[model samples]
Target: MTDAVRATPAARLRGIGHEFMEFFRDLTQRSPARFAILIYLSLILVFTGLFSLPFAAEDGRVTPFADAFFTAVSTICVTGLATVDMATHWSPFGHVLVFIGVQIGALGVLTLASILGLVISRRLGLRAKLIAAGDTNPLRTHGGPVNEGQTVQLGQIGGLLATVALSTLVIEAIIAVLLYPGLLIAGVEWHVALWEAPYYAAMSFTNTGFTPNPEGLVPFEHNYYFLTILMAGVFLGSIGFPVIYALRQHLFSVRKWSLHVKLTLITTIALFFAGGVVFLILEYDNLLTLGTQDAWDTTFQAFFLSAMTRSGGFAILDVGELNGSSLLVGCMLMFVGGGSASTAGGIKVTTLAVIALAVWSEAKGRQSNQVFGRRIPSDVLRVALSVVAWGATIVALSTIVITQLTKADLGRVLFDVISGFATVGLSTGLTAELPDPGIYVMAITIIMGRVGTVTLAAAVAASSRSQLYSLPVERPIVG
Candidate 1:
């Protein structure tokens, strides 16, 4: 009987090995973004599985499985929406899991994995280069013979990743150090102040916005220096890394800025100021700000902080206290999100810029789209349109579903749905009140946002094809 049982186990092991090998083979040929999502999902599963153990929550108390899974997904996606409060509910072990997940999500799973592989093998191949190019949205390659070697240099990859990580750490560290004095003056213990400072720094820069303290920044809300540091970190994180790199390069040579770099910087600045002004105008009498006696100071702080709230989740005032119009505006900014190739999520400012430029050209009766005196390629416009269309569809569907499930106001439900899809993590206090199914929907949206709507749509729509014939073009209609 023992021998027969052992044989059965051996057969099962052989079957598992074969299945694993086949899966690995298929994944290697898949899109790198898909593979990256798989890696992130697997990590989340593992972390959640471990947290399922009794020792994972606070006070060694067993947490509900749903909460653990939800928390895992939230952290891995870098969406700060929590079904439960982090400060009171999660143990230190769970907090560590959240921290690790946020770091990986912010840096990107594939980028981190590629870095590890490069360190181990000390080489990157042509396939890897193509994947990296796709991930970064570089200009399409001219049709030419491909070389297995000399396509992408590992040094460039390492340099960019290292630069982003180092820049984030240095900026966050400075903010943490600067914040310590304010925290200490607020009567917080030195040790608690030190710990919370870095925690806030990491949360703010990663745009996770998960605060260690229950009151959030409300305690230091009136402190100008504290708000300044937090806002700076938030703004930097929302700007795309490629833009930052380009700006850094141009700083050394003022006349050599790339068109894309120039457009991104201008759009980002314009959006920030515009959003700030609109927020000031709308919320001038709302309880979160103007209801207080220091209306001018409150208005200025609200406007500036509202701009940061688009991508980063730090809120100076209570989000629930905003009026309907203010919430609507906030939702719009969150849906538009920050720049591409950065910690921020959404359709990206570049995509919005491209679409806007395309619209302007069409209205002018131009056959070709142009931006900043440079022709915008059709392929780039197609990508931009696809991202916006797909993102809108997702947000719309999720909003409908959540509205049905939660019976919340249509505007607030749509706002939360877009917030999730953009990975903006700002809620009008609806996240905690969401039902289980609603939480799952938001979780899926977060994953889609981080992976990118266009990438996800492309993965689903991908097919093998050979172009054999060209169709004749015909004009359809006039506006």
Candidate 2:
């Protein structure tokens, strides 16, 4: 007490600073994934506060922190779920803020931090590297050591970050250029088209369904060229960064691509066909969907719906009118989502593929799960199963909460809940009507899904327990 009383204010400030540093040091060394989660949470809070300011809304009124927080979460998650109208409710400043937020969220906060670190020191310290490594590569969690060869490969972190940024810029630019004429043709003035092109491109390339046009993508539904261009943007954006980077280095040389890249492409393509076929069959005779359209139009619309189900979230038709069978397909596609390290959110296609291959191998009583002529790592299989379990638990729990809160039908509630948890933003006209509790529940789900269910669970379950001895093995009876 005597020493504390004698301490000056300056000394006390220094003591607090040192303590803060120590806290962060321990966190980074002990649980890098938790550190990354903290980084993302900090960004979300900053953005939420900014969105709550007076000028964020068009009316110059201080936007309610709840709505603002929802928007901030949605934007930072790149989820495209909105309670307020994006075009009419937001001022240009707000729009710009959201644009910046989406871009930041697309690359992830830790990724941007890593790039900034590279700029500052030209080399990340071990702690910073651990944070960046865990965020970018799921296989390299802080609970375990990374492979030696992979650690050397991380020496090119700077280059990989640059490639990710450059690839996003180039893809968005191309898509924007291609979409400009469509906006003009859709009756937008030249000046409006100029801004709208980039907006659409950003939303599309990020697999977000936020359209600048009030009527949404419906106006261009019949314009095959416009829809096709959007489809292209969505597909490229959801393909994941590692696959894109591999393509940049290897081009058309499939032999040079990584096994993960190969698996992503194959799974993505197969799901595209499977999803489209399901939609085609379910919506064939339904007038609200493809019933009135000719075969050509039906085929294109079905394909577009299939793409949207893969987390693109852009819908040409009202999803609420679809049959129960079509909704089932939608849920499956949304849950299985796009590739890992992608802007698109879900359990990830790789996770689904690994689980499926593991099941197939077990069915045939094989020694190990094999894919692309390589055996899947045992740890990867464990992670895959863990992801599915976490994803299912969240979806089930969120669905129950949402249904209880909103009293919405189970079908629509399931659809919205999955959409929220997958960050897919496709809704059956129910999002805006949700009560405050419902909105908050969805906000949590979007954050959970965007941060990743498995990643979030891992951070929660983080431990330093390294067993020195193995437990006795036991086998349980199977079906």
Candidate 3:
């Protein structure tokens, strides 16, 4: 301190810079969940500023800060609900800007930061691993307490990130190839076709509902090839990158899959097929939906809609035309969402599975939370319940706020609200017409959904004190 006081101005400035860097590292190292959340907020702000630029909009149109902010939120959150026409409202520069946001969002907020870290430092510090831990599920899976502070190794982190980035690019590239010729044959200009293919690929693979075309997916409604490619992308993307890596490493054997993988694969597939069957039964006679198509086409469209309901957001049939029962089903599916640590959002399939398992255990009077020949820890169960509880709270609060603002029907408001909270991007015709307050509310919902309930809870719980003494057990009356 004495030396610093005696030092020149340059030395003082250096000392200040060093102190700042250390503080930044400490902040990051302490709670990666909060750090990741910070990155998301910062990125959203940057994209909003970029969208606010006059050059980002159509030649004659000026996008208001609110609209620009909404679009930026949707893109960065990878929620496709749009306040305006993507193709007509945004200039190519704007589209590119949105695309960049989508790409980064789809890769994940922590993941993008880790990538940047690798570029700058050629290595990830312990802080980066803490953030990546949010995606990897180390604490529960490795049989540790909720407060376990284990960190993944640098090599494992590198491989995990490499698989995520490489797989995303490779899959998107392949889908783009499949979509290219169709775009050309559809009379799209060569330049536009070139962009649309990649755009659709990114959107689909990220499970984002955004479409590059003005008509949305309607023009390609009957195009099985187009829909198939998109469906495949969404399905694969919704399967977490961790699962994908496991599949890549051990596709030929069932033994290698972790319990988490097993549950996710089983639940995701069951949901997909069950959703298809339910829709087919419900919409079999509705002329506005599948009833208008020929028998074979109707079945395909029903299944396609089912796939999209898994947070993919690309709809061949108008969601608004579906029967009330189908709408209820859509809301349920959107709320359940895709896999853990996936670009797809919601409470996640694993959380749902855990809840169901817990229910079953209670019903059977089992002493342990058991599934897949293993005992799921108490911590996992607690986390799952917390996520579900928080998720429900968010959806309920958003529904009330949005309905109050828009004066929309309860059901329509519920659909849009849940869609925003789950980041499903599906709408019941209310998104484009939502008032400013409604839009702002939906934007906040998307952020919560994208950040995830568990992550948020963890960030808030960081300052909590550990119990040095256990409290006496007490039982409350059951429902």
lDDT of 2 by residue, 193-240 (tens): 999888888887788778876788878888788888888888887888
| Candidate 1 backbone collisions, by pair | none
**Candidate no. 2 TM-score:** 0.91
Best candidate (score: lDDT)? 3
Q: Which parts of model 1 are misplaced by more than 4 Å?
A: 1-30, 116-123, 138-155, 461-466
Candidate 3 error regions (>4 Å): 1-16, 113-131, 138-142, 145-155
Models sorted by lDDT, best on top: 3, 2, 1
* Model 3 Cα RMSD, 1 decimal: 3.0
Q: lDDT for each of the candidates?
A: 0.72, 0.81, 0.83
Give the Å shift of residue 437 in candidate 2: 0.8
lDDT, residue 397, model 3: 92
- Of 1 and 3, the candidate ahead on TM-score is 3
Clashes of 3: 0
TM-score of 3: 0.93
Most accurate candidate by TM-score: 3
Which has the better lDDT: candidate 1, or candidate 3?
3
